[model samples]
Target chain A: MKAYAFLKNTPKTTTPRGKTMMLDKGLGLNETEDLLATAGDYLDYAKFGWGTAATMDRELIEKKTAMYREAGVIPYPGGTLLEVALLNGQFSEFLKETQALGFGGVEVSDGSTNISASNRKQVIQQAKDAGLFVISEVGKKDPKLDHKLSIHERLMQIQTDLRNGANYVIIEAREAGKNIGIYDADGNIIENELQELAKGGTDRLIFEAPLKSQQVALIRQFGVGINLGNIASNEVTALETLRRGLRGDTVGQL
Target chain B: MKAYAFLKNTPKTTTPRGKTMMLDKGLGLNETEDLLATAGDYLDYAKFGWGTAATMDRELIEKKTAMYREAGVIPYPGGTLLEVALLNGQFSEFLKETQALGFGGVEVSDGSTNISASNRKQVIQQAKDAGLFVISEVGKKDPKLDHKLSIHERLMQIQTDLRNGANYVIIEAREAGKNIGIYDADGNIIENELQELAKGGTDRLIFEAPLKSQQVALIRQFGVGINLGNIASNEVTALETLRRGLRGDTVGQL
Candidate 1:
């Protein structure tokens, strides 16, 4: 059903297509329906993005979640909301509210707050036990704090999150995709860091690639099957084009 | 009817609220409606960026333009598309096609092509004669070429375009809003250049400010009555909040 179906390039490898996690900063119901109509099949998860869900009415959030669910895309609140709830000693309430809001998943991240390793593990298990898909993020929102954590530490956290029952582990690049996790200050990927992180295989890893350059680099490096996250809602179709080698960046190269 | 109307700040000056021109690269019908529903009152123009209008079906573009017009916002094709049409010697056809497509306006820009000042004046006049709203842009798309244009030259061009019947003259910053016109490489405004440009008065100028920082700074400097263009579709409501002192950036200051 693609517009230019005849121009789609065959995959260079037999690797299956990867999951795409879109960042929904704030979208109305009509906008959500529009997204699904155009690029629903290409998306796997929709993250409400860093406390943005809290800014809207609960009914609107529920409607958005239901829409995503109807389209088979798991909808989840941002990890920062969970962190805020945890700070207020309302983690259990947050989980309950997340379910009531029709969210099918929960992102457990310590990006903005300090959570002990044991607590982080428990948080992942709790969300999983609550019949929600758990995606744990590894890295800090603060650049200075992020720099303090070595590659070895990030890899170990990824391992721990997977063992603790997270469905996928996401590298933290935030929305801007610059100077965080595997990306440099200019938003370019650090090849050595990316290589080290991919040592444990990439099937369960979602690299938060918001920029087109990052998406192209990651797709080229890990084949089209590399899970990518933090994509802008409008760029969903464009990303699918890159994945399918329909875009100039990956045309004939994939 | 604003969500948090009680918390709105009073304007510091009696200047009327400025116009906002959102950049619609390629939005579907549902997305367009959602935009109108949430931020219709805040918008004055909707630009189908670059030649993206050429990429989609004619019907879809017509539907989008109709929707925008119904919401009281003028819909126009990007200036680059006009430049493309001029290169193909399809200027008249382009104007005819634009009207058939339901676009209320046309942008005449030399951002991506070279058109002599006289020809540029003709282009503007032709669009005006066609009963279309004309918005002329002043700046080259290539950063190097943009940098070569002196502020005095830019001012002269603005004067010429206004004289030629342009309803408004946009100081081009392109979509990225970086290293062009009055903005520096980091997307920061060169205060002196902006000051120089504003000497001819800013009432007829539309500054293409895509970044939030730029929007905040301009609102701060120009008392929320500075016409801004090239805003991202999703940021329309957020920009309105900034303009009305609802956002933190201009809350107390405005």
Candidate 2:
């Protein structure tokens, strides 16, 4: 049973919350299970952030992936890892290792590298073909370069990725959620850009809102159902509190 | 064995790191064990942030505290809880409960409330006499009030807390680590204020550095052994990277 179950006024999110897609930077096996036991019910996808997956012991990564799968959350390597694989001509090998490790999904992103437009589409299709749910990201990792991409360009890329077989498209905020994608330098959301990006419904889009203020702002703007990503693993329960109007920040407002 | 043991050039700290004082806002038994398994060797203290301990079930808190204690980490309730207890005249009860729950330390602070000088000193001595390591914090949690506290006042409080038998005095940066303490609005360190605070050696002072830049800055300035506090549970290993010169920011610098 949920803690404080008697608080019936806590908004029941009939729609599964895309409210939490926690970033599993480098959690060990015990940490993975701990996360499952603590906030598994609140999470949807767990992304092993950046190129970290390529750095850890393969066996440990496999165990962590299996744990996430067993807990019913989609487990995926970060897009940066995929980008690294692509850069090294190891995309196919990476996909095989991904499946061997028990990951349910694969992210296709060029956040820290570059891939041709045709290759990006082909990679997404190949990943889908490999039976992994694809979560493609649209933004450069570097703030200056990320800002250089126009809203129209990003929107087009999102549409293209979806058409090419991405289950969800992530707006890249890297892990810090600042000066990239929809967030400004102070990590605050750029309202106009966010509104433009949300021209399409946000049901399949995950905005990486790692900062608490960013999380609060997005939750307020799009209600609790907002698909938020790059949340630190520990913040999962805290984010749930905001969605259910349990925390002080959203209690009266929500 | 360390994960990247082959990365032999990673600067090993000859000095003990104060990187262990992590903020546990709300963690259960499993999460506690997971943290120990992943980073226990590095941690010296596990603090349940704010009055969160007062809000959780005593049994659950007991289990969590026992886990931390068994792992050799001194577990303690946040100073705000002690402050609340002092406000309600439940200081003795609070101390009893803390011991009952297996906490190895007690934090006494006037962060959220005023305690007369005598009361503050007495509280610190009482907590110490009760056989708990006393770690006192000095700062207002509110930004405006925090700004009013001149550097001299904070330095004096640190000295008083230490003289009253505090095992270590934590510079109050709260969990956000910005605008309220040695950091500016952007969370960057204000070097002059930090230098003034650290005029007393950092060995007895745990600077609450919750931001990556702050961690890197302090680690660079004070070497790897500098005591830090309010570190998020997940970032312990990441902070270790900076200390050991493993990550990009501190790779060559440290």
Each model's total of backbone clashes:
0, 0
Report every candidate's CA lDDT: 0.87, 0.83
What digit string (tens of lDDT, one per residue) describes model 1 on residues B1-254? 22212221336235578989999989888788777766677789999999999999998988998899998999999998999999999999999999999999999999988999889989898889999999999999999999999998999999999998999999999899999999999999999999999998899999999998899889999888899999999888667656655443454466
- List DockQ for all candidates: 0.09, 0.09
Query: Please, what are the lDDT tens digits per residue for candidate 2 over residues B195-239?
Result: 998887888998899998899899899988888888898777667
Q: List the residue pairs that clash in candidate 2.
A: none
Candidate 1 lDDT score at position A227 = 97
Superposed model 2: Cα runs more than 4 Å off: A1-22, A26-47, A50-62, A68-172, A181-254, B13-15, B88-90, B244-251
Q: What TM-score fits each model? A: 0.61, 0.63
lDDT of 2 by residue, A1-254 (tens): 87667776576445455547889877877777767999999898998766455445566767787788888899887776676567657778788878877889998987767789999999999999999999999998768889899999999999999988899999988778888899988998899999999998898899998999999998888888899999998899899888888888998776
**Model 1 chain B weakest lDDT span, ten residues long:** B1-10
